[model samples]
Target: MTKLRLRQLVIAAPGPEVADDLRKVFQLGKPFHDKAVAEFGLKNSVFSIGDQFIEVVWPVKDDAPLHRFLERNGGAGGYMVIFETDDIDAARTRLDGAGIRRVWNIDLDDIAASHIHPADVGAAIISIDETRPWGSWRWGGPKWKDEAVEGELSGAILESPDPNGLASRWAAALGIPATTHPDVTRIALDDDQTLIFQKGEKTMLEGFCVSLQSAMKALERADDLGLKSQGDTVWVGGVRFVLNND
Candidate 1:
């Protein structure tokens, strides 16, 4: 099995207002090709965090899947986690054998990607992608290098009623092992990214933790947006965003 690394975080915004609101909180870089995905019934924007990405998807039509997702989750929040795999076909085979269903697939000149149904993963949608030369993503737009900000995605928190069970399933799906702790279970991915499971009544992609190159700047930005901050973490758009300079 090839190593899978966290590549992108997809945030489902209830509307464009919510999307713009979060963009300010993170002080994210220029919006990625938002217009490129319009035909898919989505209004989206992407911000480069180091070489990784954080994308916000807003539904443009009532029938858009994001709309239903927001309603089902009880509100807007984190939606999906996409991992870049070294061999996506192998990953697909493993997932298929385990009875995990793939809801979508994208094969292009620059990238290959697939989506695993949330039912199989427990909460948020999971995607596995393979891009030539890794870190260079065609979907992020041509200016991605210049759009990068000062932080890197450290990991994401997945809240579920059965943390252990969900962790085990995810670990199996990714062909990795889960590290269990008293309060949380961790699935380590390549490039230092981790999927952490925390016990909660509802299964959800709660938040993303990041390591900032300059925490002070991020904190100042959060403050400018009138968002609350305690130490290195801040709650913005109902998500616990951590900014660590360590």
Candidate 2:
């Protein structure tokens, strides 16, 4: 069987303060600063949420891709969807057969990573990362295996003018089939993760959902931090977070 799970979600913010906002709102612990991103003229903080991660990147230079993304979104928004796949060889064949362009890719002894061109996918940059020894993620950094986090990343919501069309495009790129209904189109992934494409003015990775153990406390923290909170939703980094309380 094909083994792939949503491992990380990346967001691009206009400024670094958005990182602080996320940390406070989600009650997240210290983040791992990935020095590798400096090559792209960006700074990032990767926060561990259980086995998953939420990363925020802000552009340090005007020529960065995150800078252009921020300019288009008018602020902070979802940047990429990263997946952990046990079978990279299979994925490579399928993506190549589908004619998807990979903007960046790396093959290492410990991990294999590829960044699919956003224009080919329509929602966000798709990254398929394969780790060597099963669940050990090279990107999470050392000493993070002992860290326990209360929240779990559940899914992401992609806004598109044509939900079914975007879903089909995503399904094609992921080498899966899209299931469409009257309301939204869904692309199911492993670990009960899903990509939900919904009707909107344009195509973009709009927001994501997080399943939190201390759900109420998270919302309260969001309010106390002076971030906008409404019902079961909170606004951070100009993106909506639909809270799923455990």
Candidate 3:
């Protein structure tokens, strides 16, 4: 099986103000680009979190599904989970055999991506991308490699009533093994990232973890920005941001 490494976490902001709120909450730098993705009717800001990206997207049109997604999740939520794949075609074949549907196909000059429907995976939307010549990401802008700070994308947590079942489903879909336990289920990925499943009332994308230079410093920065934080976790744009020194 080919490797699927977590590359980016996408958040759907209810509006531009919420997006700006998150930027300040995380003390993130300027966005990668200001352009719009016409296919999704979205305008976005991309923040570099180590080699991984944290993207906040705001729908441009009233009819955009993103708006309904926000309504469903109560204003804002984790929208998508993107993975960098070693072989996209093989991944597509695997999904096809399992009767999984690809909601969108994004073919670009430097990349090819396929989006799997959330219904199929029982959680957030999943994207598998193949970059040209292997590890390059054009979506992160040309300056990402040079400008991105050093940190590690630790993993993401999915909340569900049946953690074990959802974890196994996601693991099998991504061709990974699920490690089940009494309290949680974990699927370890490349680059030390792990997909975690925790008990919840509804199955959904819950939160993710990122390692920073200093957790205390990050927390102080958040406080200085007037952002409310509990312990090492902060809520911005309705998603939990966990800061860690690792």
Backbone-clash count (model 3): 0
In candidate 1, what are the lDDT values of residues 187-217, reduced to their tens digit? 9887788889999998888888888776777
lDDT of 2 by residue, 1-246 (tens): 888888999989877899999988887878888888988999988888888999899989888868778888888888899999998888888889989888898999999999899998897999998999878887777755565477788999999888888888788878778898888888898889988999999798988889988778888998898888888899888778998986
Separately for all candidates shown, the number of backbone clashes (residues 3 or more apart, or on different chains) is: 0, 0, 0
- For model 1, the superposed segments whose C-alpha errors exceed 4 Å read none
lDDT by residue for model 3 (1-246), tens = 676799999888877776687666655667786474756788887778777898888888878889888888987888889999978889889888988888888788788999898888886999999888677887788787766766767888899988888887787678888988777889999878889899999788888787877667767767887777889897777677787885
Clashing pairs in 3: none
Error of 2 at 217 (Å): 1.3
lDDT of 2: 0.86
Judged by TM-score relative to the true structure, which candidate is superior, 1 or 2?
2
Decreasing TM-score order of the candidates = 2, 3, 1
Error of 2 at 111 (Å): 0.9
Reference-based TM-score of each model: 0.93, 0.96, 0.93
- lDDT head-to-head 1 vs 2, winner: 2
At residue 186, what lDDT does model 1 achieve?
97
Candidate 1 backbone collisions, by pair: none
The order of the candidates by lDDT, greatest first, is: 2, 1, 3
CA lDDT of every candidate: 0.82, 0.86, 0.81
